[model samples]
Target: MCGFIGFLSNTNINSENKNNLTNMSSIINHRGPDECGEYIDDNIILCFRRLSIIALDSGKQPFSYDNNNYKLIFNGEIYNYIELREQIIKDKNITFSTDAEGEVILAYYKHYGKSFVSKLRGMFSFVIWDKINNKIIGARDPFGIKPFYYSESSRGLYFGSELKSFTKNKEIYKKEINSKSLHDYLTFQFVPEHNTMFENIKLLKPGHILEKKINQKTKFEAYWTCKFDPILKPQAEKIKDIKKALEESVKLHMRSDVPVGCFLSGGIDSTIITALSAKINPNIKTFTIGFKDEGYSEIELAKKTAENLGVENINITISPEEYMEAVPKVIWHLDGPVADPSVIPIYYICKEARKHVTVMLSGEGSDELFGGYNIYREPNSLKLFKHLPTPLCKILKYISTIFPEGMKGKSFLERGTTPIEKRYLGNAKIFKDHEKKPYLKSYNKNYTYDLVTKPLYDKCKNYNDVTKMQYIDINTWLKGDILVKSDRMSMANSLELRVPFLDKEVFKVASTLTLDEKINEKTTKYLLRESFKDILPEDTVSRKKLGYPVPIRKWLKKEMYDWALNIIKNSKADEYINKEKVIELLNKHKNGKIDYSRKLWVLITFIIWYEKFIEEV
Candidate 1:
């Protein structure tokens, strides 16, 4: 809902420096174009840009508590702030002023200290400046709904809601790419937590807080963790509990002063959200994006769902050309390369929805929590790997290497033969290890596919195969890729997106369901569909899942090939990547020799990001 930038120094600051902080906040002015404010003390300077979501008239940023001893700047929504405030006042016997969520946050922090995060039940990333303790306390939300990046420079420690804010300081070094993060981006499409694509800058892990003491060391620790406790409860009992919990979460998430809307896709997740929302408010408006391509068009399904729910629906259809043109603007707004092609249309959708409402509800966390992805079906299909003779699997892998290029089923043979650790990097594995090695000028082993997957594999030692993949996704894929796109793209339009599926109460029930229930009968999200069977249309509850399907693959083969080639050929990305190799890959794809849609898109996005942010020109 807002953008904040602050710096904590070990020495006294002057007016000139204060002006610099003001300018830094201005760079991210788009995030909070409604209002702006700044607060500075001897060793800390806090600045805020307000978007005016809940308390438009009186809710300003840099809110202070305890006679200005506790000052803070925030970027996100606190849906349960009212509930939290009532509990704090009653439990701690605290007096408060202003109905602003910002004030409630300060009071809660004062009463609970670091433990305050446990009581919070919303998306947020904020920094609290403790004038008395001469320290700064910061925390990101539990599911990483909002982003927070910080860097230590000669000026001191600088923190901001977006990366561009920290880069606003001219003296601070910029354009120093973090190779590890870049490699991760190339592999996973988004940089995971604790690693940004820039050295000396890091994303605050979700559910974690940092405390930096003046003239001393800074400490970061997690305040919460999402632990899976799969239950073997009956299907009927699970469905009953799930529906009850999800409905309550949706009800709680609807608590806002402004009108709320829902993002409706043809899929079950969005359909269920829309169906539930319509039950509470029949006039609820739903937004959907339609593409010209038949396979990718979900607007018709969304329209059907809306008609069934009897809610007003808005469908925005865009041509491939329009989506391509919107890419650069979206990348600039995102502030980093989140190479999800779906981000483009999602950004446009939010931009369109913002015209009607300030706050919109979405179905984001359902996939991660309820085993929604078709890839979750992979462990079931690939369970044979666990029973395969190790030597035979290795021999099959060796045989796959001898298979000629362009041969059908070769990649399948390779993927089946190789260990899951090496083959299934994440949900979307664009480039094979062999293919990527030829592209990187200097392959950094430290950031290879194993770097991201090994830690996950180790953590899932005792978990079932399905649970292992789910746990790995929660740690890597969900926060690193999906949520990043959702949060950044939606916020870039200054629209507050609330995810009921991500609500802690909903997660509590979903996380407790057994893998068999989640992946029952070889189908993904079976439990979820069963829970909402009565509310959703019978056809919708059983429809094949088509996830945010972009026509990028088909476009790259035909219409967009020329544009993609031009970008990759002329991009300044040559400094880091092998230009000839990139062109070779594109040429092969264009000539119909290979399917390089995923890799070409990744290369094109990286080039676009470099041209916009890294290259000075």
Candidate 2:
């Protein structure tokens, strides 16, 4: 519910250097407009902008603990602070504190070191300055629900809730594309962990902690991770445990002192959240975003779901024109390039919700936890198709390329015949390996798809088919694409977005279930629905997961085609990308030779971001 920026230096500087930190924090003022505070000590400068969600009057930062030996600036809600505080008081004899999560975090760190992150349950990205050790310890939430970006420069180590905060540092030059991150961003919609467009800047991996030793080395370590732990419990026991855990998550997520709302998307995930939320408090307010197009709008469905649950539903309708208009502003808030078109609607929805509430609950991590995406259903088909001889498949892939681009079934044949290592580049595969070869400044065939999927693949080496897919998503799609967009979109509007589905307790319970319960040849999220079969309406339980459908494809073909073509043509990215090749792709897309919506959007987003953050430099 707040945004904070902090710095640790090897030496002190003048007013001009101090103003850099001030400017960095000011850019994200919308994230915490209620209050602003700064802390400038011997070798550190900590700044905070507070949104005042919980302990409004008392929760201020940079809050110090152990009599100012350790100071902290945190940007998130610690749902279990009340429990943590009580445990600390009883077990550790800690005393004298307001009921704020920030204070508990400081005390916990004072006692636990980096181990404290594993004990907390909430969405957070925080920095604690240990004056005693002269070190900065940082941690991000387990599910990547919160964002933390850091860059090391001659000035010092600067960290913030968003990348824009580091823009004011004169020493931090806008370096060229980090190729590894570029590959991931093109293959997926967003860049994966430890990779940012700028060479030195990086995203803190989820479930990981970074320890920067004074005037020396910085080390990153993973403190927690979710694993598929299949239990032998009976169905009845599973249902009871699921209900209990989910109810607890919903209740904890609503621990704010101010008004909170839920994003009801007319899907099983949102319905489950709304159903549980209303059961706790029927006055729970919910918001849903719908489009003018019937193909994308889920307003009616969300309204019915809300009505059935006896919760108030506030629906916001966005027109195509309006959605396009919000693109630049949304892109700016995103900080880096992210091509998820839904971010536009999310921005408007959060903007509207902020008018009524300071915090909003969203169903973000459900798909990754449970098997919800349609792609998970393709493994069997892919496995069968993988039987073809490599040489024969390569021949077929080459021939398929000659078939008119975007022709029906061409993509399937191309993907099916190609090897998984070469064809399946995470979920949002935009450009082909060959297509990127000519575009990248320096293409490295040495870099393979294993770069991103290897970690999860190795982790799930002993797991079942479904569990492998789940693990793959958790490491790639979940953190790289979904959580990145979720955090950026919500924070863009200065609204605190909490994902009840991502609660560690809920993850612990869900991860224990086998693949058979989660998904089979018939359907996905079966076990999840059955657990709440009695609570959710019949229609809700049986409904298929229709993703937040955006009209980007339709817009690219008509309304936005000219604007997009112009961007592609004029992009200074020609220095990195092939201008002629890009123009050809645009023309083919305009001529209906290719259904290049996703690819075009990714390219345009990257170009715009590059121009804004890199080219002008």
Best by TM-score: 1
lDDT of 2 by residue, 545-575 (tens): 8767898787877888787777778887766
Compose the digit string of candidate 1's lDDT tens values, residues 1-617. 88898889877888767877888889887788899998988888988988887877768878878899899898887878889889888998888778898899888777778788878888899999988788999999888888888887655788898887766676554777877777777877777777887888788998999999887767899888878888777788888889998888888888777889999987899888888888888888999997888888899988888888899999898888898899888887767678888888898899999999888998888888998878778666667766788988788788888989878867776867665565666676766555667778767665567877888788777777667777777887788878877877877888888888987888899888887778865578888988898889878988877767898888887888788878877887776888888888887887776678788778788889888877852
Give the TM-scores of the predictions, in the order they appear: 0.96, 0.94
Whole-model alpha-carbon lDDT for candidate 1: 0.82
lDDT of 2: 0.81
Cα lDDT of all candidates, in order? 0.82, 0.81
Per-model root-mean-square deviation over C-alphas: 1.8, 2.4
Reference-based TM-score, model 1? 0.96
Worst 10 residues of 2 by lDDT: 418-427
Native-to-model Cα distance after best TM-score fit, residue 463 in candidate 1, in Å? 0.9
